[model samples]
Target: MHPIIKIESLSKKYKDAELYSLNDFSLNINEGQIFGLLGPNGAGKTTLISMLCGLVKPTSGHFTIQELNYANHASKIKKIIGVVPQEYALYPTLTARENLHYFGSMYGLKGSHLKDKVVETLDLLGLLKFADKRIETFSGGMKRRVNLIAGILHNPKVLFLDEPTVGVDVQSKNAIIDYLKFLNQNGTTIIYTSHHLAEAEDFCTQIAIVDQGKIYAQGTPSSLIASTAEARNLEEVFISLTGKNLRDAI
Candidate 1:
C-alpha cells in the first residue's frame, strides 16, 4: 500500500529563531498505522504536527498528505485529516451537542447527516446523556471525549493527535485509548505525539523517537527496546537515545 503521508527532507525554522526546529526530517506513514512520534519538550514533535496540519508553514522541503501536496492541494488535504490538539477547543458555554454541530458544520457536514453523526459519536464515547450539558460543567475527561468527537465527525482518513491522553485519569486514559484503537482498527491512520512512553509502547504499531527536529530511532516499540542495549521498555530506549538531561524551553 502507498504511504498515506510522505515527507521528503522536511524542515521548519521560525523567522526569528536561531536554529531550525525541524531539520531535514523524512518519513513515510502507511495507511492504517498507529504511528507514535515520541519526544521530550521542544523536540519539534509539535512543530512537525503543526506543519502537517497546516497550522504552520515549512521553511523548506516537500510533504504530501494522502497524495495531496500542501502546495497545491491544501484544501483537499484538510478534508482528509483530523486534528485533536492537547488543549480543549470547545465553547465553554455551549452545550455539547451544539458545539459538535458547529464544528461539524465547519467540515461542511449539515442537516440530518451532521446531526446524526454528532449524536452517534456522543453515544459511542459515552457522552450521549450529557449531550445537552454545557461544556463548562463537564469534567476534563468528558471534555476530551467531546473534543475528540468534534475532530472526527467528518471521519477523517488520517488523524493527528497531540498529547491525546494527557491530564486525564486512568479510567479516562483507557477510554481514550480504546476509542483510538477502535478508530485505527476501522482503517483510520493515526499519528500522535506523546510523552507517555508506556502508553505509546502498548498503543503504537510503530514509533519514532525525535529530538532537535530529527529522528534518532524509528521502529516498533518491541524492536526499539530489543535494539537498545540494557533497555527493557520504551522509556529506557527513549532515555538511552534522547539522553537524561532536562529539555526545558521558555
Candidate 2:
C-alpha cells in the first residue's frame, strides 16, 4: 500500500531570513501509525507541518497526502485531513456548540449531520456538559478539548496535531491522548509534533528527531532509544541529538 503521506526534498526559507526553516526534508508516514516529530524550539517541526497542511507554502520540494498533491488537489487533500494547531483557533465569544457547528460546516457537513457530529465529538471529549458555554468561560483544558472536537467533527482520515496537550492538566492530557489513540486505532493516520518527549515515547509508534532543519534520527521509540548510547528514553535521545541549550520557544 502507498504511504498515507510522502514528502520529498522539502525546504523552506522565509523572506530575508538567513537560514532555511526546513532543509531537504523527506519522509514517508505509513497509514495507521502515530508518527511523532520531536525536536527543540526552532527545529522546524511546525514549518514542516504547516507545509504539509497547505497552510505554509514551501520554498522548494513537494509533498502528497493520500496521493493527492496540494498543487492540483488542494481541496481534496484538505477534505481527507485534519489540523489541530498549537494555538486556539476558536472564537472566544462563541459557545462551544456554535463554534463546532461553524467548523464542521467548513468541511461541508451541514444540517442534522453536522449537529450530530458535533454532539458526538463533544461527548467523546467530555465537553458535552459545557456545549452551550462560551469559549471565554472555559478553562484551558476545556478549550483544548473543544478545539480538538472542532478539527475532528468531519472524521478526517489523517490528523495533524501540533502540541495537542500543551498547558493542560494531567487529566486533560490523558483524555486527549486516549482520544488520539482511539482515532488511530479506528484507521486514522496521525502525524503529531510535541515537546513532551516522555509522552511522545509512550504515544508514538514512530518518531523522527529533527533539528536545524535536519533529521538526526527516525524510528520506533524503542529503536531510537536503543540506538542512542546510554539513552534510556526518548528524552535522552532527544537531548543527545538536539542538545540542552534553551532556544526560547520561537
Candidate 3:
C-alpha cells in the first residue's frame, strides 16, 4: 500500500531563530501504522507535528497526506486528519455534548448524522452519562477524553496526537490508549509524539528517535532496542541516541 503520509526534506526556521527547528526531516508513515515520534523536550517533535497537522508552515521542503499536498489541498487534508493536542482544546463553559456538536459542525457534520456520531463516540468513551455536564466541572481525565472525542467525531483517516497522556492519572491514560488502539485496529493511521517511552514501546508499531531536529534512529520498538548495543528497552535506546543532557531554550 502507498504510504499514508510522506515528508521530504522538511525544515522550519523562525524569523529570528539561529537554527532550524526541524532540519531536513523526512519520513514516511504507512497506512494503519501506529507511528511514534519519540524525543526529549525541544527536539522539534512538536514543530514537525504542527507542520504535519497544518498548524505551522514549513520554512522549506514539503509533505503530503494521502498524496494531497498542503499547498493545494489544505482544506481537503484537514477533513481527513484528526488532531488531539497536548493542551485541552475544549470550551470550559460548554457541556460535553455541546462541545462535541460544535467541533463536529466545524468538520461540516450536522443534523442527525453528527448527532448520532457524537452520541456513539461519547458512549464508547464512557462519557455518555456525563454528556450534559459542563467541561469545567469534569476532572482532567474526563476533559482529556472529551478532547479526544472532539477530534475523532469526523472519523478521520489519520490521527495526530501530541503527548496524548501527559498529565493524567493511570486510569485516564489507559482509557485513552485503549480507545486509540481500537481506532488503529479499525484502520486509522496514528502518528503521535511522546516522552513516555515504555508506553510508546508497547503502543507503536514503528518508532523514530529524534533529537536536535534530526532522526537518529527509526524502526519498530523491538528492532530499535536490538540495533542499539547494550540497550534493553525503548528508553535505553532513546538515551543512547539522544543523550541525557538538558535541552533548555530561552
Candidate 4:
C-alpha cells in the first residue's frame, strides 16, 4: 500500500534565523499507523508538523498527504486531515455544543447531521454532561477533552496531534488515549508528537527520534530498544540518541 503521508528533503528556515529549524527531513507514514515523532525542545518536531499540516510553508522540499500535494491540493488535503494542537483552539465563552457546531461547519457539515456528530463525540469522550457549559468555566482536563472532540467531529482520514495529553489528570489522559486507540482501530492514521515516552511506546506502531532538525532513528519501539545497548525502554533509547544536553531555544 502507498504511504498515507510522504515527505522528502523537507527543510524549513525562519526569516533571520541562524539555522534551519528542520533540515532535510524525510519520512513516510502509512495508513492506520500511530506514528510518533519524539524529540526534545527545539528539535524541530513542531516545525515539521506545522509544515505537514499546511500551517507553515517549507523553504524547500515537498510533501503529499494521501497522494495529494499541498501546493496544488491544499483545500482537498485540509478536508481529510484533523489537527489537535497542544493549546486549546477554542473560544472561551462558547458552550461545548456551540464550539463543536462552529468547527463542524468549517467542514461544511450542518443541521441534524452535525449536531448528532457533536453530541456523539462529546458523549464518547465523557463530556456530554458538560455540553452546555462554557469553555472558560471548564477544568483543564475538560477543556482538553472538548478540544479533542472539536478536531475529530468531522472524522478526517488522517489525524495530527501535538502533545494531546500534555496536561491533565490520569483519568483524562486515559480517556484521550483510549479514544485515539479506538479511532486507530477504526482506520484513522494518527501522527503525533509527545514528551511522554512511555505513552508513545505503548501507543505508536512506529517511532522517529529527531534532534537538530534531523532524524536520528526510525523504527518500531521494540526495535529501537533492542538497537541501543542497555536501553530497556523508549525513554532510554530517546536519551541515547538525542543526548542529555539541554536544548533551550527561543
Candidate 5:
C-alpha cells in the first residue's frame, strides 16, 4: 500500500526567526494508521501539520498527500483531507446544528443530506440533545465533539487533528478517542499531535517523539517504550529522550 502522506527533507523557517522550526524532517505515514506526532510545546508539530494541510507554505522541501504533490495538486489534496484545528472552529452565537450546517456547506454539502449527516454525527458523539443549543452554552467537551463533527462531515481520506483532547474531561477525551478510532478503522488515516502520552500510547498505531523541530524517536508505542533502557511507559520514554529542560522562547 502507498503511504498516505510523505514528507521529504521538510524544513521551514519563519521570517525574522533565528532558527528553523523544522529542520530537514522526512517521514512516511502509512495509510490507515493512527499516527501520533508527540512533542512538547513549540516542537514544530503545529508547523509540520500546517504545511501538510496546505495552510502554510514550507520554506523548503515538499510533501505528498495521497500520492499527489502538495505544490501542484493542492486542490485535489484538500478535498481528501480533514483538519480539526486546536482551537474551536465554531460560531458561539449559533446553535450546534447551525454551526454544523455552515461547516458542511463549506465542503459543498447542503440540504437534507448535510442535515442528516450533521444530526447523525452529533448523535454519535452524544451531542444530539444539545444540537439546538448555542455553542456558548455548551461545555468544552461538547464543543470538541461538535468541532470534530465539523471536520468529518465530508468524510475525507486523511484527518489532521491538533490536540483534540487538550482541555476536556476524561469521559470526553474517551469519547473523542473512540470516535477517532471508529474513523481510523474505516480507512481514514489519522495524524495528530498531543501531550497526552498515555492516551497516545493506547490510541496510536505509530508514534514520533519530536523536539526542537526534529523527530527524536519514532516507532509503535510498545516498540518505543521497549527500546528505551529502563523506560516503563511512553512518558518515561518521552522524558528520557526530551529531558527536563524548559523551552521558553520569547
Candidate 6:
C-alpha cells in the first residue's frame, strides 16, 4: 500500500533554540493505518506534526501528504487534512451545534448538509441531548469529543491529533477511540502524538519512538515489542529507548 503521508530528511530549528527540534526525521504512513508518535516531553513529536499540518514551517527538508507537497500544493493539501490540536478549538460562548456549524462552514459545508452532519455526529458521540448547551458548560470529555467532531465534519482524508484524550474520563476516552476507529475503518488515515502508551499499544497499527529530535525506532506495535529483548509492551519499549531522564528543559 502506498503511504498517505511521506517525510524526508525533515528537520526543524527554532530561531533561538540551541538544538534542532527535529533532526533528520523521515517517515511514511500507509493509508488507513493508525500511526502513533510516542516520545517524552520536548522530544520533537509535536514539532514534527506541526510541520506536517503547516502550522509550523520546517527549517529544512520537506513532506508530502497524499503526494502533494506543502511547498507547492499547500492549498490542495489543506483541503484533505484535518487537525485537532492539544488545545480546544471551540468557542466557549457557542452552543455545541452552533460551534460545529461554524467549523463546517469554514470547510465550505453549509445549510442542511452541515446541519445534518452536525446532528448525526453529535448523536453518534452521544451528545445529541446536549447539542444546545454552551461549550463552557460541558465537561472536559464532552469538549474533547466536540473538538474531534469539528475537525472531522469535513471528512478529510487524513487526521492529525495531539494528546487527544488528555484530561478526559475513561468513558470519554473510549468514546473518542471508538469514533476514531469508525473513521479509520471508513478510510481516514490517523497520525497522532501522545504520552499515553497503553492506549497507543491497542490503538496504533504502527508506532514510532522518538527521542532527542530523532526517530529511535519504528515498527508495528507487536514487532516493536518483540524486537526488544524482553520488552513486553509499548511502555517498556519507550522506557528502553527514552530512558528515565527528566526532560525538564525550559
TM-score of each: 0.98, 0.97, 0.98, 0.98, 0.98, 0.98
Give all candidate RMSDs, comma-separated. Answer: 0.8, 1.2, 0.9, 0.8, 0.9, 0.8
Candidate 3, residue 88: the lDDT equals: 95
Tell me the deviation in Å of residue 204 in model 1.
0.3
Question: Candidate 2, residues 144-214: lDDT per residue as tens digits?
Answer: 99988888888899999989999999999999999999999998999999988889999999999999998
The alpha-carbon deviation from the true structure for residue 186 of candidate 6, after best TM-score superposition, in angstroms, is 0.2
Q: Kindly give the number of clashing pairs for every candidate.
A: 0, 0, 0, 0, 0, 0
Worst 10 residues of 4 by lDDT: 241-250
Q: By TM-score, how accurate is candidate 2?
A: 0.97
Ranking by lDDT: 6, 4, 3, 1, 5, 2
Top lDDT model: 6
Q: Model 2 Cα displacement at 121 (Å)?
A: 1.1
Model 1 Cα displacement at 17 (Å)? 1.1
After TM-score superposition, the amount by which residue 37's alpha carbon in candidate 2 deviates from its true location, in angstroms, is: 0.5
lDDT of 4 by residue, 213-241 (tens): 99999999999999999999999999999
How does each model score on lDDT?
Answer: 0.93, 0.92, 0.93, 0.93, 0.92, 0.94
Q: Write the per-residue lDDT of candidate 6 for residues 207-235, one digit (tens) a residue.
A: 99998899999999999999998899889
Error of 6 at 187 (Å): 0.3
TM-score (C-alpha, index-matched) for candidate 3: 0.98
Model 3 residue pairs with clashes: none
Write the residue-wise lDDT of candidate 5 on 1-250 in tens digits: 5798889999999999999999999999999999999988889998999999888899988889888976688789888999999899999999999999998999989999998999899999999998899999999988999999999999999999988999999899999999999999998999988888888999999999998889999999999999999999999999999998887866
